[model samples]
Target: MPATLPLDLFLGALVTVGLLAYLTYALVRPERF
Candidate 1:
């Protein structure tokens, strides 16, 4: 169980970054996407 901790944290960070990028893109270009 301890070995999976890093993987979980990495995934969470990845997801958060992805969501932020998507939101930024949508906000910057509402007509393109």
Candidate 2:
């Protein structure tokens, strides 16, 4: 269980940031096709 801490945090942060970035990009540019 302890060994998974680093991996878990890395993935969690990656997903959270990725989602936020995607949302922001979408809102900033809605004319993209």
Top candidate, metric lDDT: 1
Candidate 1 residues 1-33, lDDT tens each?
465668788999999999999999999999997
| C-alpha lDDT values of all predictions | 0.91, 0.88
Q: Which prediction has the highest TM-score against the true structure? A: 1
What TM-score, over all chains together, does every model reach?
0.77, 0.71
Q: What is the lDDT of residue 19 in candidate 1?
A: 100
For candidate 2, write residues 1-33 as lDDT tens digits: 465569788999999999999989999999982
Could you tell me which residue pairs clash in candidate 2?
Answer: none
Off by over 4 Å in 2: 1-5
